[model samples]
Target: MRWWDVEALMPLERELFGDTAWSAEMFWSELSHPETRWYVVAENPETTDVLGYAGLLAPGLEADVQTVAVAPHAQGQGIGRGLLDALIHQARERAATSLLLEVRADNEAAIKLYSARGFERIAIRRRYYQPGDIDAWVMRLRPLT
Candidate 1:
């Protein structure tokens, strides 16, 4: 993602995540740490519309999957997988020995996606999500051989 994409990215973020969505300033702060961060966006080729966005933070041998969101109309079209793949690639590029992420316990689809991508449950963060009693499953993809 570039400086210009923030304008288009924030709206989709709010639509997918609602009140807890990351603010514009938060994105700026993340981008400021390019040495340890990588973010990417997918767009409609014809209209140049934002379809999805994902970010990764690799600090040392560990990498965290910070966020992955897809436009409502664009879900189930491999955009999420593509974004995830990009993150995994970026993590490997950054010399991350393994990758980790957290997903809401209720989000089976996302959990399935991550599981299929080699992430395995390692722990749980109780009541990790706000405004309710939702929990988060902390998953990790083991180090590559």
Candidate 2:
């Protein structure tokens, strides 16, 4: 995504992630390293509103799904899957042999989506999230092909 999209994405980020939402500087930092990072945003065709966004970081043979978020109103409409597909494609482009991600354990829908896309739970970080003490599930997908 371009630097211009950062401002447009802030509201959505806060809405989706609440206390853990990323700041504009964080997005800028991620965007600055385009050589090893890939990020995309989905916009409403009519209003141009940010519907979803996803990012991937591929520094070597392994890539990480940095973040993925879909607006609540836009969920269940394939936006998340499409974003994920973009990340997977980007990972492959970078010759990433595997993709990894960490998701809050209570996010059942996200976990199901990752599982359906071939990611398997590799471990769990106890109470990885703050304030609420939520666990985080670490998942991985190998043979990116």
Candidate 3:
């Protein structure tokens, strides 16, 4: 995603993730390192409002999904899947053998999405999410080939 999109994405990000939402500087930092990072945003065609955003980090043979968020009103419309597919394609392009992501344990929809996309739960990080003290499921998709 471009620097311009950060502003447009803030409201949605805050609304969806609340205390866990990323700061503007975080997005700027990620975008500054385009060589190892990829971020994308989906927008409404008419109003050009941000519908969702996702990011990936591929520094070596293993790539990680940094984040994936869809506007609540736009959920279940395949935007998340499309964004995820983009990350997978980018991981393959970077020659990554595995893709990893951490999802909140209570996020059944997201877990199902990742599972359907070939990611398997490898472990769980206790109290990985702050405030709510939620657990995080560590998932991995290997053999990118």
lDDT by residue (tens digit), candidate 1, 1-145: 9878988999999998887899999998899999999999999999999999999999889999999999989989999999999999889888899999999999998998999999999999999999787999999997732
Ranking by TM-score: 2, 3, 1
Please identify which of the two predictions, 1 or 3, would achieve the higher lDDT against the true structure.
Answer: 3
- The alpha-carbon lDDT assigned to residue 88 of candidate 1 equals 92
Question: What's the distance in Å from true for residue 39, model 2?
Answer: 0.4
Q: What is each predicted model's overall lDDT from 0 to 1?
A: 0.92, 0.96, 0.95
Counted clashes in each candidate structure: 0, 0, 1
Can you list the residue pairs that collide in candidate 2? Answer: none
lDDT of 2 by residue, 1-145 (tens): 9999999999999988889999999999999999999999999999999999999999999999999999999999999999999999999999999999999999999999999999999999999988699999999999897
Candidate 1 minimal-lDDT segment of 10 residues: 136-145
- Tell me the TM-score of each prediction against the true structure: 0.97, 0.98, 0.98
Model 2 residue 51 lDDT score: 94
Model 2 Cα shift for residue 89 (angstroms): 0.5
